[model samples]
Target: MTKKFVTLDDFLGTHFIYTYDNGWEYEWYAKNDHTVDYRIHGGMVAGRWVKDQQADIVMLVPGVYKVTWTEPTGTDVALDFMPNDNKMHGTIFFPKWVEEHPEITVTFQNEHIDLMEESREKYETYPKLVVPEFASITYVGEAGQNNESVINEAPYDGMTDDIRAGRYFDDNYQRIRK
Candidate 1:
């Protein structure tokens, strides 16, 4: 991850252009010095490497999002994206571990994620399979609609307005723990 800490922006409930480029990572080390430099192999064209990216507005909220990817061998996965203060926390629920005891769940902070090889390969491979896919967020509202202003309602406990009402759900969308 480039940044040690990721401060959450206003992307809580708003869907906007989210872009990323993946390429061969090259780290150059000086012959006598340990200092290194990194670059993308095919990152530029002519004199510039136009990075590949997919831009789409993403409304990330605390809830379960289904993963429909190609790769017939790969199983399904769900993500629970939670926004706390300036951090977006996520819990990955792999299909194989959903039913297994001591579920093999992966939890990490989004701010600390790098589109490069820093994060899980799934983060890069899965999304690339589909373009402009709507990432359904679990926002609790009156009639199936959620807004940014509403946080910590049903499955999520808001850190900002002291609105710790309703019970919270785990990464697998289970209310096992409050």
Candidate 2:
């Protein structure tokens, strides 16, 4: 069976692009000092690093779309969308549908939760998948404080320190506690 793909632009909906700054970093350190004479011996210093970042736009629909085929033997297919350029892409799962129906048509609409009273009525018959968003955190700490291995070991330890010191929740910790 031959598969066909389509883009989301063919459907009706709104496309939105969201972007945020991922941030920057820096590091510095000094090694051994001269013991014989009053002069400096082995020493090292490191610089900083930064990153540029952006996110792609996602398409949001308010209702459910319908996928129909003429042949009972035809296989069901999944739909895909592209918000960056406003396109809807999908592949036909069943070749029988093309052979029997000749021309197959699918409806793509916003998947609004309020349209149907019951959740089951809304998505009981279709496939539901959630795509999670990705985020990046740039590490910028004092020299010798930003070791990659240490940084990765207990990434959230810093947060615990803030919480334990009551800085995380207590807004006026500086004045109130002291």
> RMSD in angstroms, all models?
19.2, 25.7
Please write out the lDDT profile of model 1 over residues 44-109, one tens digit for every residue. Answer: 110111111111223333331211221111223222223222122222222322223111121111
Backbone steric clashes in candidate 1, count? 9
Give the residue spans of candidate 2 off by over 4 A: 1-73, 101-178
Residue 37 error for model 1, in Å? 36
| Candidate 1 stretches greater than 4 Å from native | 1-108, 115-140, 143-146, 150-178
Give per-candidate clash totals: 9, 18
lDDT of 2: 0.23
lDDT string for model 2 (1-178, tens) is 0112133222222211111122111111111110000110111101111111011222344322222222122233333333223233333343432233322212110122232223323223323222122212121111121122211111122443343344433342222232
TM-score of each: 0.19, 0.18
Name the best candidate (by lDDT): 2
lDDT of 1 at 133: 22
C-alpha lDDT (0 to 100) for residue 72 of candidate 2: 25
